[model samples]
Target: MNAPAPPPAPRPAKPLFPEEPAERHTLSVTVDNEAGVLGRIVGLFSARGYNIESLTVADVSPDHAVSRITIVTTGPRRVIDQIHAQLERLVPVHSVTDLTEAGPHVERELALVKVAGTGEKRVEALRLADIFRARPVDTTTSSFIFEVSGSTSKVDQFIALMREVGLVEVARTGVAAMARGKDPA
Candidate 1:
């Protein structure tokens, strides 16, 4: 019993890939504009332990027969491909396009910002909103609701500045995206 034959050495952990960075992806999915379609798609992501950073869905086709669902997510490349494959298999999904890799797409979000203040603070808020190209949608003596639409970064910066002036609340529509070319996504 030479010290219990010296216990076997602990094995080093081996990763599938040594240094694969997690990447953010924007996916555009076309599906039938029918009831329960969104729920099913969301369920698939949840069941697989994947998170949806931002999602927006709306009817796109004039007849209201089709809807486009834009989803922003983060994962390794392999995972993103898997998401695409799985989405294609869904009964309601007609197409799943990875817009992030599809080249030349525009992404935007709309936010309604409400700030409460009077006097100089209120004036500052309005001035800052104008700088951001945001318009006052609703206003009163004490508060104002400004409508801002732009890239996610622009909206975020404007909101941060508004906080100093008197940010009371924020309501944002999740990212909406579309390919740049004349062809559909």
Candidate 2:
């Protein structure tokens, strides 16, 4: 009465991949500030089908030979690792560090937000801006351009509230990130 080994115990169902969920990451890459170096780095992302949420680059050295690029993107953890490895292999890229994972870091983005409203809506907008510590960089009778600098989430929250009031347009300086300690990225 073996009973066919009880049908060999039912197997659990599982997805073919079950890949890790994608998450936002900020990557800081130090590279040689030369012609076509940025293009090559961007090409790598395009070739691999990755998307860049925001990108900013500026020379960091007095000699103008070194530059730092802050790239914001979202991808699975494994894909992020791949990006780091590939970036390091680039000829001009000196180093690639994941600021989101590297101990503690500071990230900030500046946004110029325009809101157009009148009466109570206008007053409400001003009140909200004050609470957010936003400065009115430009002001006219009909509208005000607020200059806000803070973490990404803070800027997003402010923009969302403005939409409910009278959000006109926004100019943002993508994320700028750096490691907190003395160690260089």
Candidate 3:
């Protein structure tokens, strides 16, 4: 009978636990600028065991009634979708947009990096900062506080390089993201 139908066609076995690589997603949440609102939003993430890579909040409305919160996190696609849904259910949240999935977006971060070194290290640090278009906001004999702003990866690279030269401290403003084109994110 056709060679026993080739042993009934072996079937591929599915793994018991499917592994999905975590994906980074930048979410823009619009909420009322009121007391405890930010706390509640932040609490949700903590309660769910979700980690926030970057978070930035600013009042956007002219009257300071509305605020825009940019939160960057990494998780599986299903987890991201769940986060979106939960954010939408918040009472003060006006809207939640996944800028990463929405298409082309621009994300930038500002970092105040402090490097301490002498001689060639100092010169090298300055040279690297100049190459990255970072300006020296403050300078002293042994250290310099640089104001660097650019894409997240660029800032990270600059900081890593500075570490080799003598990175003392770093203050990052987190990520501020916006969708491309004319539409508001």
TM-scores of all models?
0.90, 0.88, 0.90
- How many residue pairs clash per model? 0, 0, 0
lDDT (Cα, tens digit) per residue for candidate 3, span 13-91 = 9743368768999999999999999998899999987779999999999999999999999988888998999999999
Q: lDDT scores for all predictions?
A: 0.93, 0.92, 0.94
| Candidate 3, position 44, lDDT | 93
Model 2 RMSD in angstroms: 5.0
Residue pairs clashing, model 3:
none
Stretches of candidate 2 off by over 4 Å are: 1-17
Q: Model 3: how far is 161 from its true place, Å?
A: 0.5
C-alpha lDDT (0 to 100) for residue 140 of candidate 1: 94
**lDDT by residue for model 2 over 1-185, one digit each (tens)?**
65655467778998433678888899999999999999998999999878798999999999999999999989888888888899999999998999998879999999999999898988999999999999999888879999999999999999999998899999999999999988876
For every candidate in turn, the CA RMSD to the true structure comes to 3.4, 5.0, 5.8
